[model samples]
Target: MWLYSEIRTLGDIPRHYSRITPAAPALIGADGPVSWSQLDIRSNQIANVVAAADVVPGARVALLGKNSTRYFEILFGVNKIGVALLPLNWRLALPELVAILQDASPDLFFADREYADVAEKAIASSGLRCRVIGYDSTRPGRSALDELMSAASSDDQVVDVNPWHTAILMYTSGTTGKPKGVQLSHQSYLYLRLCEHLEPSFSYTSEDVMLTVMPLFHAMGVGLSLQALYNGAAVAVYSMPDPGKLLALIQHDRPTLLPLIPTVIQMMLDHPDAATADLSSVRVVVYAGSPIGLSPLKRALQAMTCDFIQFYGATETCAGVTFLRPDQHRRGIKLESCGSPLPLVELKVADSDGNEVPDGQVGEFLLRSPSLTTGYHNQPDFTAHAFRDGWYHTGDAGYRDADGFFYIVDRVKDMIITGGENVYSTEVEQALQQISGVQLCAAIGLPDAKWGERVVAVVVPEPNAVLVAEQLIAQCRELIAGYKVPKEIVFVSSLPITASGKVMKSVLRDEIIAQTSR
Candidate 1:
């Protein structure tokens, strides 16, 4: 067993685990299991190579890859030299990647073999002059990660690392506009681990085997993997999320914990293999990234014999601010709540004037925690606006009940103004989700000459199910106010979602506008 007092920096993790449980499995991937001692030595070698590359301290090292064990090695290795690790979203298009790379301007670019083409395009588009290294590739001109590791020494070296120093430069999803790089300090992550250690329900043990399908580029994946490593737990990583493959991994690995998004869980349950899959090893299942419908939640609870935990937060909050635990997953008002704040987190719903709002009144969610990001990198204006009055304005609109449970309404920017009345998109979407045929739906505001903006809904129906616009509107009208009802209903085969499972409302809104213009 390891004490929280032993962990001070990212460099301390491998050293502590290597000393205490040298033979324990620290990482288990498709290749094989890597023991703590091996991970420690390999990471040390990578760190030495990175430091000897003539790269200055506090420089950015960008990684473009899917989930892999090498990704973790590079992550911790960069941490040892006090350099920030910027995990680029490989799902992004060449143009988007170019824009982000230009903004980040990392000193080094590391790409997985599969993403070499995209990385090259991004580097070319941005005109960045940096060393390009390929992981698990024999491509000429580009250095190989394995060769670098083999040639470097495994002996650990001391580097000046400060808690307040930036450790990660995580770019936002950019659903609203250009992606902003969020600067997270080493202290922020350390504080997060402390919070997890203090909370028994969220804590991990060395005996636990955690199955992580979430993209390592996202905050949820990074935080979960780090927590498992810090606690000496073994991590089973899947490069990508596939329902059949995930079920197979669960049955084969017999992992104790699984963290996933609702969309992935829904797909897994819908798969034919789920019925017979041996999921008995799973004791806890953590889900977040978006609001899940009641039907799916209920079905998941009935099918899987495990604790269901709903985490609510954005990248800026380092994954979770509030947790909806299994015991609170009842069929009543609690179903609508995202649960209470986590330990060391302070939350309140504030009105436009920045004063705390009364219970049940919708307002912007504000939070204060040691785990919050330091600021947005290179965007002082945005950082100033987001971090104000000693609180991080989450930009998510929600309300607190008398019982202290927080219920999210919608994103402040996503709220619709119809006939001078405010309509929360989430309210309409929740009502739409209750309808039997609605598989997925996104509510947005379309520009209107009269109402300024009108409510519009794009829905995806369940397989073999047919939906009518009038019937859906009528169903929503019965549950919500008339103005909140979507004026326009467009049925599609699918909705645009980010890699992390969040609906890309900005993309949908643009498509609707284009159609209207046509």
Candidate 2:
């Protein structure tokens, strides 16, 4: 009974849901399901707690915690008072955390007790005077969140807020340098739901229970969860990234919706219980974070027995600019395509001069969507360069087919130039994935004496599967061009993966370079 028209901002989502389905399960955390009414009251309690900490409108509050119902409560509660919530990636190092803390200069900080020591170190290192509240327990004298919320009133905090006000201060993955905070307004997150409602291209129903396993700090995890909530769907929050536990949850909860990265999907399939696990309850599997290879896609399609949707987007665009719908997943028909732009999403492939390139030509992806981020926080110069003429330069290299399907070649920086020929690392990785024993693979450009850059591949083999470097190369040759083939393949047990499920290619490249130099 929650109508999209009634909800103006992120705060209104819980309030609207509580009115119609007070007893409906809003969130299922480790502690169990929290009803819509309870979530609304808890969010009000959190808002009061945030206000009492002297945090006001336009200020920021940073949270360092894993996935939980409390995260949503804090997010909505902070939004209720017009304060943006910056959810820090708990996987970050102390100095990294300190850097973000110093950059944001938040009004207050919240951390789970698990990260107490690191949070204290970061606060001390950054010399931030902001008060710290622990989700589990604060410092000796100060009251923790539970104590404060228990004492605070559950009355709604009414603060007039602009829909354009920043609700999330999400930092980039920081592969290149310091992580830049991308400011996403309430409208940036909400508009996509409206688009979905109008189009229904991968619509969420009230009966759907979205099981989110990705880290809450990432865009995909929080974004998908909010999208589900906006549609009156229950969200099951699983904090850890354990594939075994994730599979067990699927069997037990029978969640209808799954938004998972391909890496996690691979791990789940490789798990011992995957064969026997009951995954029939799942109606849709949405894969994102990175491009999934054909091998894993086939395996998932066979195993899950449900519709598979692939989303392609970036932090700049809060929602997916393009989606490969279930019907488009047919074998040997545009399998590599990420599908056309979503409704209300205008997309084009542009050359370096910013002119739109003809279809079927590789170029940078330029997109403009209603849910697009306004800009990077405190980085006007960087923002000016990226967002130009009403289009966001995505730095992704790809081309659209004649039929309107989009194919992502590679990240512009990730493209390898070998012997004066362009080689897409994603293409090479995709080819390598076709090999029988290959489990996970990352292709990178390494410094070469002859070629400007040589293609080097780091591969992880399946368990108990035997593989040969020569044999894999021979197999890859059949799948792709000879020039695109990797010059060398290094076998490993696992590749470095980010918390968001992306392979840390820069880190992997550096490690490979260091090992080769030695």
Candidate 3:
């Protein structure tokens, strides 16, 4: 009974600084700032509620909410129990939410008031014996997290969870089939977050504020939020991606770190708010989740004086294993490299047979690190296939240069086969990004009666930007071989992306297939 090994979170309020500086304000909200001590008390109270819920060890608890105080409190509580925390994507459709709820089949579902209706319908349809709890719902049937916290004590409860045991279940953007739950362990997350905590040089400190518009369901959101909490930094969160409001928060809060998706950045640059926002206090602007378009990339560099750190990772990898440092993002290096493997992680390229491929050889990127996930939930076969040879096969085809820098060619599933020739979609997308009119693009394979599958370019042209299909094809023809050129181009307003900020190529492929069939 004495061997309680499961709980690994910083359960107790540690001995932190107090009088070193003035406690003017911390955790900013719409109303005002919440002090550090306040956050700690709420966290402690929530931890008690989680334990009082009778959530046994290894219970799966789904946190379905946006970025708010309640979400933060619930996460702390979940950590206390050492149970698997599944963060649901609020942006997804009701049906999609239901699918994940059913698939995870958690012991409890905690959602935000905004998603209460959807949660109820999804729960009823799936018959998920899940006890529903939310910030706003039935006073008794649906437990308000804050209320529960007030009724409980401020003591930390430890569970017998090993570091190797699964801690989080993050589902990837399921474009083709159902979403796959990636199981990250405490050991992996510890190494991942610990390695990313930046020891500040001069500017940023706990005094600085930050804003996070990125969805909390993804690994990026989790990493950023945890980093701030772990370091006792303050953050101003927004549930929606409103560029104007985000700018106001930036100017109002004088944030030090702003991590967001490229799409959101693009919106801000195009909006009227960009001209007046006082971003002088911003020190680091972290961007990832997808490829950055040249136009927005240039604007972002010009707009913010902060360093741009782009991370290449996924839900299964515990967020980051490779980092494209701000220095490596020069005009010459940006297009060619995704930088080298991080110091805390290991990376290698391997062939289909699991043998390590030679340097500079293009193959599946195999990653072995303490930060990589243990496996997929309830998917033994998928896990076995992915975690072979003591490494997680990233399913990405890329090569490492002589200097040990890694370059992602494209997803193996996204490789376009045209006339018996293989064309990496990233190569084509990179070329398309350089075109004068092309704003966003994705290269996917579409069914062709003559060639089985033809290279298809799905592009989002700039406003009033027009180009003949033939001219676009010629542009690709000049850069790549004739066979590699996109056989057709489909222009759309925007590209469909997953909640984690990854482009859903499966969705694009399906759209192209449907149109081709018609």
Candidate 4:
């Protein structure tokens, strides 16, 4: 058996797996299943081509594409030559893409055929000088990825890649301000895999098939895929998240593991075909990125006969710090808790003065782990503030129970202060979720004359469900204190969510402010 400690760099994964399980399926996509031997050889060919380009060691190579098999090939290839891979989020606007390109300043830019125009616009806008190649395009001046791979040698080259060498430059989701690049090293990802090995809930075998629906740009997507590969399990890539398509794939491919966000989970359960879908092959379903409501969770448990695992963390922590295990779900204990920290991770809830708080008291959550990123890419001052006192401040308000389980309340910045009372938006949102007609809701503070701020709830009702503001407020008051109930309610068709499936609370706040002013 191969141990986690023996793995040094990302390149070692394919090399080791191919030797032991060369004929086994490594990746399954729309095209078909690719064997481990093919994965190793193709990645080597891409690495040789990249090495022959004469780029300096540690150079940034940016990739703009949706989820696909070629993405993984480029990922390993970039790491094989000691260069950092920056997976650009194609969902961002052109200006956002340009800003990131300007900051990364990659030595080479690779884009999929569908995103070539956007890549050209971003490069032209940012004034970045780099060789642009299309992953599957054969345009006039653009070199096709297939041609490059075919021409390069398949033999692996010896490169000096250390554990501390930076492997990825992932950009944080810019909800408040401009996104900052986070520098993650090979050691960080290796440590994360080690942590996963310690937890029984995350156990994987070569026989397991993982269905991946999250975007490759997000940390969750990358971590899940890497975990599958690390364990020598086969992975199936779904380009995007669609409830109907996901169900169809599950029925056809019969993947044993499916990792998704809460939003997608709810959509899958609500799909009309979900009742009759043959999801018996699924053994474990993992969800993360945001808190899931109790109502939706219960419904999902009834619908799908699979163990549910919930993870909690940010991009800085490599997408997981704590996991609510399946055993806890089976026992129905601490349903609201995000659960205990991983084996090698330390968690603390600290006050604004950086002092530890008592259990059951909400405070800012801070974590220390080997899997954490070194710091933000370029902003030294921001990095200093974030990594104070040898802990990465998560900026999330949460508390620990007497049983040692952690519960996330809300973001520190998302707290609502109204009439000298403090209100956590997550708490209010949880209360609102209990209402029968409400499908989704976000709580925010709006400007008020009498009170310092008024709590406002933006809701998206369930289909064919009529909801009145007064009735919803009455229901919320029954569950929580009157002060915590929403003073005003606004109904919308849908909430603005990020590609990773997190609600954009700042955008909602701005829209509410504009509506009140009018």
- Against the true structure, what is each candidate's TM-score? 0.80, 0.80, 0.74, 0.80
Residue-level lDDT tens digits of model 1 in 418-503: 54344567767877898999999999987664455689999999999989999999877765557678897999898889999999
Model 4 Cα lDDT, one tens digit per residue, 110-184: 899999898888899999887777875223224587788888999988687987877889986332435689998
Model 1: worst 10 consecutive residues (lDDT sum) = 136-145
Q: In model 2, how large is the Cα lDDT of residue 186? A: 93
The CA root-mean-square deviation of candidate 4, after full C-alpha superposition on the true structure, stands at 10.9
Q: Per-residue CA lDDT of candidate 2, range 1-518, in tens?
A: 22547788899999998999999999987677889999999899999999998899999999988787788989999999899999998766565678789999998888888887778888999988988888752232244888898999999978888889999999863334445899999988878876666665566877899998777887888899998998889999877557788888998778999988766788789899899988999989988776566776887888878888888887778757788888777444677788887788999999998999999999999998999998888889888988988899888899998999999886765766554344667777877877888899999988764454788889999999998888888777765557677888999888899899999988998999999999
lDDT of each residue in 1-518, candidate 3, tens digit only: 00123214433212131222226343566656656565555666766676677777677888777776556556656755677788887655555567778888888888778777877877898778878777742232245765676678876554545677666788864323445788877677666654564312213346556676666777887766655644557777666557787887788777788887666777777789788778888878877665565566777888777777777777787766677777655443654466676665788888888787888889988887767888878778888977877888877889988888887866775765443233567767776777899988998876553344578899999999987788998877655446667888888899889899878998878877787679
- Please identify which of the two predictions, 1 or 2, would achieve the higher lDDT against the true structure: 2
Runs of candidate 3 with Cα error greater than 4 angstroms are 1-26, 136-143, 158-161, 173-176, 197-208, 330-336, 356-361, 415-518
Better of 2 and 3 by lDDT: 2
CA lDDT of 187 in candidate 3?
70
lDDT score of residue 512 within candidate 2: 96
Residue pairs with clashing backbones, model 3: 5-160, 5-161, 6-160, 6-161
